[model samples]
Target chain A: MRVLGVDPGLTRCGVGVVEGVPGRPCTLVAYYVVHTDPEDELPLRLLHLDRSLTDLVAEHRPDAVAVERVFSQHNVRTVMGTAQASGIAVLAGARAGLPVQTYTPSEVKAAVTGSGQADKAQMTMMVTRLLRLPEPPRPADAADALALAICHVWRGGTRSKLAAAAERARGGRTR
Target chain B: MRVLGVDPGLTRCGVGVVEGVPGRPCTLVAYYVVHTDPEDELPLRLLHLDRSLTDLVAEHRPDAVAVERVFSQHNVRTVMGTAQASGIAVLAGARAGLPVQTYTPSEVKAAVTGSGQADKAQMTMMVTRLLRLPEPPRPADAADALALAICHVWRGGTRSKLAAAAERARGGRTR
Candidate 1:
C-alpha cells in the first residue's frame, strides 16, 4: 500500500510518500517541505500551503495518509497557527477520499525509533536506517513525516496479519 | 487597505476578503469556505488546501491578512491539529509577501462586540452590524474570520497612524 505522511506547520510543513505492501519493506517515493514567509498575512500564507499541498497530492497519488498530532504548550499563538496548518492537511486528505490517520508524537517516535522519547536526531537516523536511504531526509519535519508513515505501515501490517490468521483458522475448522 | 481574514480548519477553512482603510467601513470583497475530505491521505489533503488557498489569494489580492491566534488547552490532539492549520495560513501569507497579523479570539471578540466574553452568536451579530451586511456571514467560521479582519482594521489602523505621526514629527524637527 502507498502511504503519505505529513508533518504540518505554518511556516514549514513536511511531506513524505512511500510505497509498499503490509508485509514488505517500503520504498521512499518522494519527500519535501512546504514553507511560507513569516511576515506575510495569514490568508496568503494559507494560500501558499493549499497550493503546495495540492501539488504534492496530485503528484504522489498515495492510498493513505498519516499526520503527526500537535502537542501544544504555553504559546497560545503558536499553537493556534499550528492547528490551522493541521486543519489544512486533514481537509486536503478528506477532499481526496483518502483514509487519513493521525498519530501522536510519542507513538510515532516509538514506532520508528523503538523509543517514545527519541529526539529529532535519533528519529531522523532511525528513519534513514529503516528506509535504507542513502542520506537522511533534510529538514527534521520531513523525517518526522516519513517516520509517521513507517509507523502506520508497521501497525497496519500487524493488524492485517492477525486478521488473516483468524480467517485461516476458521476455514480449517469448517473443512 | 484590503484585509483578508481566515478561520482555519481541517475540514472547512473559512476565508473572508474585505476592503477598507483606516476610519472607513470595510467592504466585503469575497468570502468562501475551503474544504477537504477527511478520508484522503495527509499529503493529498494538504495539497488540496494549498491549491484552493492559492486560488483564493490570486483571485483577491488583499493588502493585509488577519488570522485568529490559537489558544492553548488541555487536549493535545486538538491543539496539534489547530496548530497545523494555523501554520498553513501563516505560510500562505508569507509566500505572497503580504503583512500577516494574528489576533487572539478574545481580542477579536472585544474589538467587534466590545466584550471579550461575547459568545459566537453575539460576535456574529456584531460583525454583521459593523460590516453593514444584510445578514451575518454564513457559517460561524466565516463570521469569526471576518471579525478578526475587522479587529485588525480597528486596532492596526490606530497603531499605524500613531507611528506615522511620530515619524512625521521627527522628520519636521530634523528638517
Candidate 2:
C-alpha cells in the first residue's frame, strides 16, 4: 500500500510518502517540508498550504493519506496553529478523495520504537532504521511523518483484514 | 454589502447572513445552525461542516465571510474542536475567494453591545434588536452568528472604504 503522511504545522509542514503492505518493510518514496511565512495574511498562508499539499498529493499519488493527530495540554502558543494546520491536511486529503487516517503521537512512537514514550533521538533512530535511510531525516518533523506513515500502514492493514474476514463470514451465513 | 458570519463548532455550527452597508440598517437574510453527531468520526464530521458551509456560502453569495476566532486558556475538552471548526470555516471562505475576517468574543461583544464584557443575555438582546427580528433567534448559537454578521458588516464596511481610499491615493501617485 502507498501512503502519504503529513506532519501538519503552520510554519513547517512535513510530507512523507511510504510504499508497502503488511508482512513487509516499507520504503520511503520522498520526504520534504513546506514552509509558510508568518508575516503573510492568515488566509493567504492557508491557501499556500492547500496549494502546496495539493501539488504534493498530485506528485505522490499515494493510495491513502495519514495525518498526525494533534493534542496538547500545554503549547498554548502553538496549539491553535497546529490544529488549524491539521484541519488543512485533512481537507487536502478529502479534496483528493483519499481515506485520511490519523494516529496519535504515542501510537506512532509505539509502532516505530516499541515504546509509547520514545524520545526524539530514539524516534529518529528507529525511523531511520525502518526506512533504511542513509541518515536520520533532518528536523524531526519529516521523521514523524514517516512514523505516521508506518503506523497507519500496520494499523489500517489489520483493520482492513478484519473487515474482509467479517465480510466473508457474513457472506457465508444469513444476514 | 452582504456578510455571512459563522460561529464555528464541531457539535453545533451557527450560520447567519446579513445584507446592508455600514451606515444603513443591516437586515438578516437567514440564520440557522448545523449540528454534527458527537459519535461521528472526526473526518466525517468535518466533511459535514465543510459541505454544509459550502452550501450556505453558495446560497447566500455573501460579499465576505466572517468566522469567530477561537481561543482557550481553559476549556480543554472543546478547544481543539472549536479551532478545527473555525479552520474549516476559513477554508470554505478562502475556497470561494471571499475575504475571511475573524473576531474575538470580546470584539464581537464590544461591536454589538458597545461593551467588551457583555453577558450572553445582553448579546441575545442586541442581536435581536439589530436584526429587527420578530423575536430573538432560537438557541444562543444562531444569535451569536447574527451578532457576528452585524459586527462584520459594520467593521468590514469601514475596512473596505479605507482600502478604496488607499487604492485611489496610490492610483494618483506618479509611477
Candidate 3:
C-alpha cells in the first residue's frame, strides 16, 4: 500500500510518501517540506498550505494519509498553527476520498524506533536504517514525516490482519 | 460593508452574515449553523466543514469575513477541533480574496454589549437589540457569530480610519 505522511505546521509542513505492505521494507517515493511565508496573513498562509497539500495528494495518489496528531502539551504559541495545518492536511486527503489517520508522536516513535520515548536522533537513525537510505533525511520535520508513514503502514497492516481474523472467527460474516 | 462571521466548531459551526458600517446599527443578512455528524471521522468532518464554508463564502460574497479567534485556554478536549474549524473558515475567505479578521470573544462582547466581560445572556440580548431582531437568535453559537460580524465592522472601520490618519501624517505617501 502507498501512504502519505504529514508533519503539519504553519510555516513548514513536512510531507513524505512511501510504498509498502506488512512485513516488507517500505520504499521511499518522495519527501519534502511545504513552507509558507511567516510574514503573510494567517488566512493567506492557511490557504497556501491547503493548496500545497491538495496538490501533494493529487500528485502522490496515496491510498491512505497519515498526519501527526497535534497536542497542546508542546509550545503553546505554535500548537494552534500546528493544529490548523493538520486540519488542512486531513481535508486534502479526505477531499480526494483517501482514508486519513492520525498518530501521536510517541506512537510514531514507538513504531519506528521500537521505543515510545526515543529521542530525535534515535528516530532519525532508525528511519534511515529501516528505509535503507544511505543517509538520514535532512531536517527533523522530513524525517518525522517519513517515520509516521512507516508507522501507519506497519500498524495498518496489523489492524487489517486482526480484522480479518475476527471476521473469520465470526463465521465469515460480513460486518 | 458586508461581513460573514463564523463561530467555528466541529459538530455545529455557526455562520452569520451582516451588512453595516461603524457607528450604525447592523442588519443581519442571514444566520445558520452548519452541522456535521459527530460520529464521522475527523478528516471527513473537516472536509464537510471546508465545503460548507467555501459554499457560504461563494453565496454570501461578503466584503470581509470575521471569525471568532479560537484559544486553547478553553476546553482542552475541543480546542483542537475549534482551531481546525477556524482554519477552514479563514481558508474559505482567503480563497475568495476577501479580507478575513479574527476577533476574540471579549472583543466581540465589548463591541456589541459595551463590556468585555458581558455574559452570554447579555451578549444575546445586545445582539438582538443591535440587529433589531424581534427575538433572540437561537443556539448561542449563531448569536456569537453575529456578534463577531458586528465587532469586525466597527473595528475594521476604525482600523481604516487609523490607517488613513497615519498616511496623512506621513504626507499622504503610500508606505
User: DockQ winner among the candidates?
Assistant: 3
lDDT of 3: 0.89
Worst 10 residues of 3 chain B by lDDT: B166-175
**Candidate 2: which docking quality band?**
medium
Q: Which tens-of-lDDT digit does each residue in B1-175 have in candidate 1?
A: 7778888765778888877776667887778888877775454556666667767777788776777776576356555545565666666666676667778888988888889999999998987887899988888889988887788788865664576598688883321
Question: Candidate 2, residues B9-122: lDDT per residue as tens digits?
Answer: 989999999998886678989998989889766766788898999899998999889899888664789888888888889988888988788899899999899999999999
Candidate 1 chain A has its poorest 10 consecutive residues by lDDT at: A155-164
Q: How many residue pairs collide in each prediction?
A: 58, 1, 0
TM per candidate:
0.62, 0.91, 0.91
All candidates in order of lDDT, best leading = 3, 2, 1
Task: Give candidate 3 misplaced runs (Cα > 4 Å).
Answer: A157-175, B157-175
Q: Compare candidates 1 and 3 on DockQ and give the better one.
A: 3
- lDDT by residue for model 1 over A50-70, one digit each (tens)? 678767877888776787776
Q: Against the true structure, what is every candidate's RMSD?
A: 8.3, 3.7, 4.0
Question: Model 2 off-target regions past 4 Å?
Answer: A160-175, B160-175
- Candidate 1 residues lying further than 4 Å off, grouped into runs, are A74-77, A157-175, B1-67, B73-102, B113-175
Error of 1 at B99 (Å): 9.7
lDDT of 3 at A63: 84
